[model samples]
Target: MATINVRRDVKDSFYRYKMPRLLSKVEGKGNGIKTVVPNMTEIARALSRPPSYPTKYFGCELGAQVKCDDKNERYIVNGEHDAERLQTILDGFISKFVLCASCRNPETDIIIKNDDILMDCKACGAQNMADMRHKLSTYIVKNPPAQASKNQRKQRKAATAQTNELGGGFENEEGGSDDDIISQRINKEAAGLSMESKLAQEDWSEDTSEAAVAQRMRELSVKGVAAFAEDDDEGGESKYELFGAWLDEQDNNTISDDDIIAKAEELDVYGKYKACQVLVQCIFDESIAAQIPKRANLLRKFVTEEKHQKAALGGLERLVGLEYKDALMKKVPGILMKLYDVEIIEDDVFIKWGEKPSKKYVAKDVSKAVKKAAQPFLEWIENASEEEDSD
Candidate 1:
């Protein structure tokens, strides 16, 4: 009944994430030899993934047949296998499907969108598309988890109910029904020889005097200003414009960090972590290694959660992956170490980024090279983690 961290890469004994150790029993004999996982359901529940996913993954890895009996809750892999070997294979499934690509958290749910499978992290709110190159992805796409289907149905029902509530009611008239009022208004509008009236009205134009024109222009100006003010009150200044202007002012040393924070609040960009995105975009140009400490204060102020951290990292990735690929390919470890030293990014975040080279944020070749450059740091962290585990 011993439990271990869901992510074996994490060596913290007090790590919040855990699952029961893999248990297996060899069954049958000779030609009919197989392995049975008695507690697969319990392990799957702890990992927040379907039992079939791991069961099928084992088969794919071992080049054997597998059977998943949902009705009986029995998962069997053909050919005799030991618990230790199966557990190693299970780690592959955990990394590919259960763990969040951004935060490396196990609180993830699989979703199907447009026939593509995606892993959505409840912890970080990152939607990462599953690598379709894997055989298990095809299985997941064709046979999605039942919980996702139920949630989709629930969402559809809630949306339909909201639509009904918004469009259901009719305004009550004081004297008559809405239909009667509409009918009367239409009749009055159409009354009294419309063709003759139209001909007469064509010849009778309104005043075109300079005074009249000036008065009309004044009225329009007043209304336009009032409408603009109302819109400003509701939506505030455009966030992009405000952030851009603040960045320009900062380059000229006309504004302090306090000034920018206050302006972000006024622009309604502080609470949602939009300021962190802007700060990343503006503070670091082609090189972020030396600027990590300089912008650490801003990152700490705004990047409070995994989502915000991921967004800031995303901006950095764009800066390096697009414009400074050579620099990233050379100094990835130094840049990552600087970010880690400043506590701007977490170990898991960097580890996950280094483990998988994502084309979503950078070119495939660039992502690969960047990740390759980060191997030394990644290996150091892994060794450090093992040392921690030993202690």
Candidate 2:
């Protein structure tokens, strides 16, 4: 029933992507002993890959024969194997097949072209060719999935619909001349425009009051700010300023997480980590431990990269380690566990962070003390990894 980060390398307990833990049951004995992955289909669904891919990957890695019965939803690898060993091999499959080389997100679709395998990332829109040196590429090329046929059918249907809509303009039941039909269409459009012009002239009005003028100016100013904020080329300045002004206008009351996420989307701040930096400062108080879980959705929406993840974690470090040091010291591990559960920080990121004092988040001494406080959780993760390796 336990779940782990989809990207096994990511140790964050709070990571948004997760998969059911690898489960294996050893069957038979002696030369006939084999490992059956009871939840191969479920894990493959979580990774957005076919169950056979990982099963074959295990076979290739372990030098054993494998059987993948798609109809019966059973995956078996020859020879005795433990869950921990198979789980480790699964990570290799994930790195080669699922994760995008360019953006590192696991949202990728495999493409086979010119006898080569390509990975197309849906998140960052990058195309990367799978290394042909891997044995799995040959299998994938030979046994391609059915997604391509479905996509082609959808495309053909869409093209037919578009052609029909455009073809409607030139239909001639009575076999009229092309020139005559064109002229008739032009005349009809001209008449409609003329009617619209007359209606516009009749509806014209002007408000000359000073109040109306002031209101119009305010509306225009707001519109200009919104336009600037939504312009992606303008960087985060406009978004930060606009969000700052909104926060300032809220008086002393806290803003709702939904409102914050909505505003971030409206301002086109989704991909920019700087917006996350600004959000952390404005949204949380001294007691960030209690607020982290509540605001996890917003964090997940914005923090997709290592930089953004580190930035958000750094913000939390400053909030808890500096402002509420005395109150949160004893609760540091629990707070970190919550962050991990929500996937705010990965294992490597958190472990590397706790290993040394970095001025990136706070003063040298404060960071050192914070990392020291997090030692217990770090040790627990290390111990777990050791146990898995021993198994």
Candidate 3:
């Protein structure tokens, strides 16, 4: 009945996400021996994934047959695998399937679109593609999760309720009359709250409107993120272009990170997220993998948020995928490893980047080529993460 962190890579004792420890028992003898997982249902419940997924994953990884007797609530894998080894394999399943590629949160729903498998994260709103090259992906596509239907029903119910609220009516989508008395009672209770109490419950400081965000940006004044502000007004685009021009003029051999910061501040684009993209594209060339360690501190300074990390990745995509495709494309994996080693980019960010191609920085085909070249490093990152968890 022991529990372990759902994300084995996360060693925090107080981690909120957890799953029941995998329990394996070997049954039969000789060629008839098989490993039975008595608690797989419980484990899958905790992970919000179908129990069949991990079972099939075990089969695929170990090159053994897996059997599931759902009515009897039993799952088994061929061969006499021990609990310790099975646990390590389970960690790999969790990393590839359950955890979000962007936030590493275990709260995700499996979504299949066309030939692609995607993990839609509830924590960070990032939709990450699963590694379809894995043998389990084909199985997952053939047998979608049962919860998908329930999720669709929930969405429909929420939509109907929202329509009722906005239209000031108690009727549902099917033209059926809702409970008039209950609706009146709910309205009466809502009307009973004092305006002062409502005002007290509201937190004005957390305003995320455009005006508020613009005001904050103005007050902060080009620390290093102004170039990547969410605003895309003509003035903002002009400032970004000017910053890019200035960055193109700097010599990578002589210009220090401090000098870059000073110029960014002078140009009033220091704190913008897009500034990271421009800097990365202009600062590094074919020798980017080798130069990353030397300029890792500068990257750390700019990549303060997820969006900034995304911009930096976009820059790399442009550099390797577009500008120097022949020279640097083959080295994409090593380049990414260097970025990871120096902490210039995080595992989640790069993993998400490698899962799919984006055309925001480079051509769609070029973006795909870049990600294709990075597959080896991406697999290494996932494998290394699982191995770390085993320790």
Best by TM-score: 2
Misplaced by over 4 Å in model 2 are 1-238, 241-258, 286-290, 389-391
Lowest summed lDDT window (length 10), candidate 3: 168-177
Question: Of the candidates shown, which would achieve the greatest lDDT relative to the real structure?
Answer: 3
- Against the hidden true structure, what lDDT does model 1 obtain? 0.69
Clashing pairs in 1: none
TM-score to true structure, per model: 0.38, 0.43, 0.41
Per-candidate local distance difference test: 0.69, 0.71, 0.77
Q: Is candidate 1 or candidate 3 better by lDDT?
A: 3
lDDT (Cα, tens digit) per residue for candidate 3, span 1-391: 5799787765656454679888875654446567778678889988888899999999999999999877545688999898889999998998899888876667678998997899987655799999899999999999988655677547644633532453544444422334534554565567676666888888777779999999787546553345454564244665677667767887888988888888777766665678888888889989897899888767765665567888998988888876888999899899888888765565667777878778888889988988998999999987766665566
How many Å off is the CA of 64 in candidate 3? 44
TM-score of 3: 0.41
Model 2 has a clash total of: 9
* Native-to-model Cα distance after best TM-score fit, residue 353 in candidate 3, in Å: 1.1
Better of 2 and 3 by lDDT: 3
List the pairs of residues colliding in candidate 2.
11-347, 12-346, 13-340, 13-341, 14-340, 14-341, 14-342, 14-343, 15-343
* lDDT by residue (tens digit), candidate 2, 1-391: 4789877765545344579889876654456567778679889888867899899999999999999977656688999999999999998898889888875667678888999988987655789998789898899999876574566546544533332333424423321222433444555677799999999889468687999999898667656665665444455376666675665566324667668767766665655666666666566665666877777756655665567666776766776677778887777788888878765565666766677788965898887887788889889866755565566
